[model samples]
Target: MSFHFEYPRTIAARRPGEFKPAAPKFHVRWQAPVTTIVSDYIAVQRQASDMAAERAFFQRMRRAFDSAYGPDSFEEMRQTDEAGMVNSIVVAYWTDIVRYALWKHVDSFNAWFRSTEREQEAVGYWRETLTVPYDRMETIFSEPYYHAGLARTRQAALEPMYTAGYFGAMRDRLPISAIDPLNSPYGETTPEGNYAGGPVRRVRVDVPPNVVSIRSGQVWQKAEGEQLDDYYQNLQPKLETGMAYLKEHPETTGYLSLRAIVHLDKDGQELRETSKHGYFLALAQLERWAAEHKSHLDIFKHALAMRRKYGADRQVVTWHEVFVLGTTPSLEYINCHPGTGLLRFANVWGNPPPSN
Candidate 1:
């Protein structure tokens, strides 16, 4: 017999009036000249066997992050997989690129990378540094009362643009060639694309004493021919359904704090694989949700069944990482819409209230 479990209404849902809009305006901002350090630490060798070593590597990096940038730096949310894996990412933002360059050359930072013992460990590391100038980027916060991402920089806000709809909309302002080269591997023809617009979706659920905030990021890739058709027709709907399911059933899905779906884009620069990352309140909560949630299990089984029918070559998960992180209290937000980025966590993280 099939089992159906009913979930109670979450606190936020019960008292919708109490969860008032902190910031209703859409604030726009340009990316300033800053250094962004992207690091991926993976347990590639003994991925399944060396759990202890994988954890140790994470702890070592956490200590390094605390000692180096601490609270002053803009640290984005760390992403991790729901399916257990010893793969994680740490993204640190620095307003002064020069300082970051100098710190890399310092003895302590230099020694950590060069240590033979660390090099031979089961984990593998990859790093990239990007110096983004003011015009090269753009950011928007639908609810300005909460701060996060570039909002932590305290940059000034400009009026929002109708064209500024999605995560990569700013890429449109860049030279078209930067996105799709004339001599492309996918083909010489431009690929079909779609962008979902409007404000970032924020779902706040209050489970009595504990209140959880859920945010989303949608990163789409250009695809050609049948692949593109399948993405829009088949995969896209399923994804939308999943998102709706979470929104409708917050009591069961409350454990999920963040969900980002990134499509593979090897032909273009950066992020080469298609993957999903979900952040939970804690590792224990994630484990329990993964094991007990019926909707989650159905989706997991559907993915496996699809892979079996389509074959592994047709569906490849190149690489995935999962990270559990604590909130950085020292981060700053200036003239930002109160509802941006990690600022959504201000109340939960013990930060001061947003100044309208």
Candidate 2:
């Protein structure tokens, strides 16, 4: 199904947060020196003996990336070969934080990991890491979808809601301690509803336009036998539960709209020189026939609200640096229907991109 959004205001905060740093998904595969089970086990055992050293090295590495590339630096997209012998690929969202860090450090990282010292210490845990930046990776698109739809008639006059009531109401959801007009990016304003609160949860607004895009990151630290066993044991059940929930509520059901993002570009002058990825075509509409389905819409809103509250801390496996700042209160906007014709606006890149 196809959807459209229109707004009189050119600047309005979004649900969950005004702006989220782009975190492209990733898939990494490296060539291991020992593919055989005995050799691989022996290598892992050696690495296991020195897991602390690797972790400490990565901690320092992460700090450097944060200092030089910013928090969203490692939000690269990753994929593993579902088929045999395919090269593993990493598809990262191209942000300055990511670009600079990868451009500067990836080669160095490869050199270090493959050095005789590291390989001898931690076998089988890593091969050589390869990276491929993607405009929009497929893993995210393959997941179930959730979002709001909004449309306003053309006659709606554009205005700036940068400091309007909507923002104030959803102030709690802002990422920063508070909205500092002098320093913060406009997109990082209060309206975005922290990292989790959306229009329904934070402020009074129409249902947001469908979620056309998303980016995310994950990290797996090297661990030894006992540590790995304990960690995975604790993690697997949660992952299983979450997967079960998604399986039960697949995108094909409910008020869901799925889009294939075709293009992505960084915030820049002239705008044209920035990155361009792909176009989106709606693949399914769970709410297509139910234009007036408030119940189904509420279901999605409820799920998101819960996710914002619990997913990040307990269920989700995510990179460590990024955090949810605040959330918008769950509130709804009531539209006084006009004489049939309604105002509409198009999808736009909200605020300026986060400065790395």
User: Could you give candidate 2's per-residue lDDT for residues 1-356 as a string of tens digits?
Assistant: 11112224334433335543232221211122111100000001122245454345435444444443322222111121111111111122222334434544644543554344542332222221112121111122101121100001111112212221121222222222133221212221212222222222111222222221212222223334643453356443443343233224433322111111111112111110111111111112222211223433343343344345444332322310111211211111112111000101011222223232
Count clashing pairs, candidate 2: 40
* Model 1 C-alpha lDDT per residue in residues 11-93, reported as the tens digit of each score: 11212233332222233343443323222211121244565643565455556556453323323222222333323334455
Q: In order, what lDDT does every prediction score?
A: 0.35, 0.23
- What TM-score would each prediction reach against the true structure? 0.37, 0.24
TM-score between model 1 and native? 0.37
Measured by lDDT, the strongest candidate is 1
Report the poorest 10 consecutive residues by lDDT, candidate 1: 202-211
In every candidate, how many clashes are there?
A: 18, 40
Top candidate on TM-score is 1
